[model samples]
Target: MSGYGVVIPAFNAATTIAETLRSVVAQSVKPDAVIVVDDGSTDDMAAVINALNLKVRLLRQENTGPGSATTRGIAALSTPFIATLDADDLWLPTKIEEQLAHFRRFPQVAGVFTHWRNFHHDRPDAPEAVTVPGWSRSTMMIRREVFDAVGPIVDPPGGRGEMIDWIARAREAGLVLDMLNEALTLRRIRPGSLSYGRDAARDRGYLEVARLAMQRRARNRTEPS
Candidate 1:
């Protein structure tokens, strides 16, 4: 039997953490271990975790960005495969089971990810769901060895470009991530999420991520085969 560990990097997510935890707990394929890294949230994140009575390992630290928190959480786990979920997002019950099955079928792949569905809380009369096609951070289940080869995610200063930077780096490293062709995660569109808002700093952060990734690709190309 094979299983994966889950790492959730949360910051000031008291309102949604409970639901998020429940979603993971309800997974058809339970995680072998669940680690949540609280990045200096003023809210009662600890209390929420405690109240759940789940076997979750909690870690605390100063207000580091999500990238750093995720790194810490991954370092704390020893599972062969690792997955991530945003504090406000929900994973469908079959997410891990299906991804793991894909891995077994194509052991050469570095990871598996799925498209995501955006659930908007603002418009009650809006369509029930809107499908977004692309790789999402929360939907990923990565092989541990791939991280060693490509390196941990490069979290931009504002934490906006970490996933983009990571995917770019992985592609440059020849890591192949399979698309599951399904929406396995529900991304909540609500206030206070890091995903919310766009600003000059955020734009610059994306450019910086692209620049760094291009440098890595060029460097990898020059290295001896």
Candidate 2:
């Protein structure tokens, strides 16, 4: 992976987008290209991106769920490796640099994920930091071939299960996924954020993904290998 690209899926994130972009811009290892997918924001997200005049590309599409928006951004990029970032989240200066280094060390690993810290948008003074155990889209840098092997991201009905489902499927396919165990991404907790609160529809999507994963496992066990 000589070069990497970032895809940020945003919707009505006019307020926090600049901070997110700033984080990407300050990375120790700069991205080859940055693509921001404007998921039909009613807010001034487009205006804000344009106003910044940063070396980023903005693509607009009808209001699709974040999963679809992110997938669209991925499809538009030709980089060997890609990372996804939410418009509200921030990556530490060495986030990409460390991940690329890890990839160099373990070239067989198809994906690299790191621990992440969470902070509320309102609480910057003493932001509660934690090492998130599982993988999240925002914390991952994956080879493009992994997507070709795993298939497109699963767009759950209401949203919020794409990353989970993709990781599950990739694991089932025997992909080598390695973790750095360092908190590199800062996830922002804010009102109305999809990860902020529990929703029945979103929860159902997660359960459905779990169900499918289990089914696949069971079927694989029964098959004549």
Best by lDDT: 2
lDDT of each: 0.84, 0.88
186: Cα error in model 1, Å:
0.2
Colliding residue pairs in candidate 2 = none
For residues 84-199, write the lDDT of model 2, one tens digit per residue: 99999999899999999998998899999988888889878234555775488888899999988988787776677888999988988999999888788888989898888998
The numbered model that scores best in TM-score is: 2
Global fold similarity of model 2 (TM-score): 0.94
Candidate 2 positional error at 165, Å: 0.3
In model 2, the runs with Cα more than 4 Å from the true position are 125-128
Output the TM-score of candidate 1: 0.92
lDDT of 1 by residue, 79-151 (tens): 9999998898888889888998899999899989987887764543233466665576799899988877877
